[model samples]
Target: MKKFCFAVLSAVMLFGFAHTSFAEDMSPKDIMIKNFFVNRVKDSKSESAMTLINESGQKRERKSTGVSKLQKNGIDNMRLIKFISPADVKGTSNLMIEHSDGDDDIWIYLPALKKVRRLVSSNKGDSFVGSDFSYADVIGYKVQDFEHKITGSENVDGVDCYVIESVPANNKVRQDNGLSKRKSWMRKDNFVTVKGENYDLSGELYKVFKASDIQFVDKENNKWQPMTIEMTNVQVNHKTIVHFSNYKVNTGIDEGYFSQRNLERE
Candidate 1:
């Protein structure tokens, strides 16, 4: 009675643990679609996202409110932002993924254009802060963009997920050129990512990243994390709930705090 194996990709490429990669015979719906893209790039010290931006069919009459901080995801970090929505663009300031490949080099710390405006995204399918989520569908990809396969299983909100579909192999990211196809549902007893949907570059259905309110930020261990988040934005219809309040996990943040002048003075 001995069968022990644990290298899980060198403990997730050296101490990250939640790495995720399935199909050794997969089926709890392919380990919940390989732990839903391995917890969608797991590794967090601090994250608080709240983005609400409506810019058409003017009846919510134009809205805005965004606040973020990811501090260390490498590539010169510092993602401390603030834009308290509306009221004439209330004190703008954003700095995300400051510059690794400079794919989404956003920086606009304008105390009324007091400087810092370099959001040159040549069209990674654009539109990130103004909602309808783009900017390469919010910066992500490591372990080579796509080719995971495990397409089967559903029922989402009531558990029983794992319907993975990620398809991007580079026709410049399959012609949509940035984050074209992605659909995940994951959750077979842990792993997270309860549902996701993103399709832009004229394929419609912009963003629908959902998740519920499960706690256990570290309650001795039953390990669950998702206080809330609900980015709608289906083609400028707008919807942002995100309420993950005061979270702190693993706290080790420091890759020079993802610099870019500390993301414009974090």
Candidate 2:
């Protein structure tokens, strides 16, 4: 009886040590990679309302429908956003094809111009459709493009989070994104970013990003999606609030829908 009890105790101790070691071995980059993969779905469709508030508190609203699909090659994502309302911006659309190995491709169609123009990939730092969010913010910054380290841990909205600091991996990337550094608070349980701070070329706080009203879009897959995302430009006191609704995930979106031809579709 004594030998049997000793064996059981030894087994328990070994298991505990192994678990702790595994947790400690996960680096900040691993955590960020997990966060990136967990939040993204194979395909998604949603309708969203974007509200832009200027320095004087004046507000303008735009509504749009968006669809995203993982490319057939399984290494990239293609997304399309089509504006549906507001007289001036109606029929405006943007299409983005995100590549894992190279710069993303973006095309925008403006109803006023009645032309589809391909945007410079490096112009991702520019404001997205006059909103506080940059193009990079909308399509997401690739995890491999930066080096991340865990600076500390804190609580965001009562949830424990890992505070990670990320910087551009090289001078070219730094210039492309127009950001010196970025910091994000990622929830420990879900690996979702609850808040983020962006620094400009001068290393000044340029924008603040906050995600709230998280909901489980795929409970079976343990996937959580934010219902509301807001980006505030600290220097300009401009803000954009995006509220997502009618979210559908993994609904077999057609890959052809992300093409530039669709950008001009009325």
Candidate 3:
């Protein structure tokens, strides 16, 4: 009887192993697409605190309110951010409209200038408001613009993750983002990126990203969101820590709220 029980256990274990292996056989592009879909929210509103620390330990903090809504076509996201704290940056705002097939639209309003300006540049790698994060970091890289391959698998914070390496498909794409390649450790279960390393044109590590404090934002949908995200510039020794709070999902935000006219509205 003991021998029979052992045989059954071994068969179950073998079946489980095969199932896991089959799931992991997905291509890199498929994995990225899955990750993108898993992270997408219908609409969300939140307030966040961004702290920037320099090499010398000097610190600056900015508080902002953000709103994001998915477009009706379900292929784009419109986001607006309004700075509210620190007298120097108060009343400043930025709007980004990310599209599925083309370059994203970006606009900025500076209180000091008292004018709204549209940003039109080929370089999407520029630092965002003097923070370690770049424009690409905010809007995300388009999956179709790059080539992806699974390099290996590893454990991150006790979670199993698939390591994916992404490279631009052409010189134009590489020039636009100012990145030669990027490697990300995506959690196997949820497809969330837990860690990432960005390489520059010279193939040197430029920045590192880490996500933590994950929490369920929509239990019914089995949706998870990260409460804290950190990016560090390796060469400059600068770091930006973003903490999100007061998250409300599926808020039914008006599409017109993402317009440039609304960007300048008080």
Candidate 4:
């Protein structure tokens, strides 16, 4: 039984590799599908510094640790992030579990509250830990939930990229992500997104996102990670920048480590 299971797993992994290997003359949806799993490493852990800047140029910084692992199916991902700095926000943690149906389950543990609160779907658009990134952004939008089209092509920092525009397939998806439309600039070389424009619920430009300092964490699997990410809310003149360090992948992190018990623990 074990041997058969192992063989099946190997074939699945090979299929995934083959899917991305032959990428020439692909469609817009094909590109989006490849982008979705571009960095789906088996497991990873990293330390991060998050900075939030307000309209008046005031800044609030916090440190955090994050860990993520792929589920048995090798598609959905489970992630947990815990704050580790600045007296006020310390000991706060968030847990996110991706669902196959495009609806993710999220929970947050606040130190002061001493209880875990489940984040409902309605709150998916709310800011994450007061940062410009929303809960849905943290969890990511499933490819099937949106209709993707190749809008155009452009060069970002000398690298050729494809500008893909995505719109919600239905009202539920739009409300869930609080986004009417999104445009992403993905590199032709690696399919990594370097820039994005997010339109608000009213179909007005709202946030601009930029990613830099890409690192190949899993070279064997062609996995890339962005060391720095910035999201700016143009409407409010506020922004958030997150820098990740000490990033490690495929460390054999135990699945149990992503449980609520660990998220709530100080």
Reference-based lDDT, each prediction: 0.53, 0.85, 0.84, 0.87
Predicted candidate 2 versus true structure: per-residue lDDT over 123-167, tens digit per residue? 778889999999998888877679999999999999999999999
Clashing pairs in 3: none
What lDDT does model 3 reach? 0.84
lDDT for 62 (candidate 1): 27
Ranking by lDDT: 4, 2, 3, 1
TM-score of each: 0.28, 0.89, 0.89, 0.92
* Candidate 3 local lDDT, 96-180, one digit each (tens): 9986646788999988989998897456899898899999888777776789999999999999999999999999989999999
Q: What clash pairs does model 2 have?
A: none
**RMSD to true structure for each model, in Å:** 17.4, 10.0, 10.9, 4.2
**Candidate 4 TM-score, true structure as reference:** 0.92
Error of 1 at 261 (Å): 25
lDDT (0-100) at residue 106 of candidate 4? Answer: 86
The residue-level lDDT of candidate 4 at 24 comes to 78
The digit string of per-residue lDDT tens for model 4 on 27-47 reads: 777787677778889999999
How high a TM-score does candidate 2 get?
0.89
Report the lDDT of model 4 for residue 260: 85
**Model 1 lDDT tens row, 1-266:** 11122234323333333323432355333354344233322234443455564555343222323333333332223354555556565556566663333244666777665677876644555665565546554554322345656677788768876677666666665553445677767675675777788765556666788889866565443346677756676665677655656666545555465455644552
Clashes of each: 6, 0, 0, 0
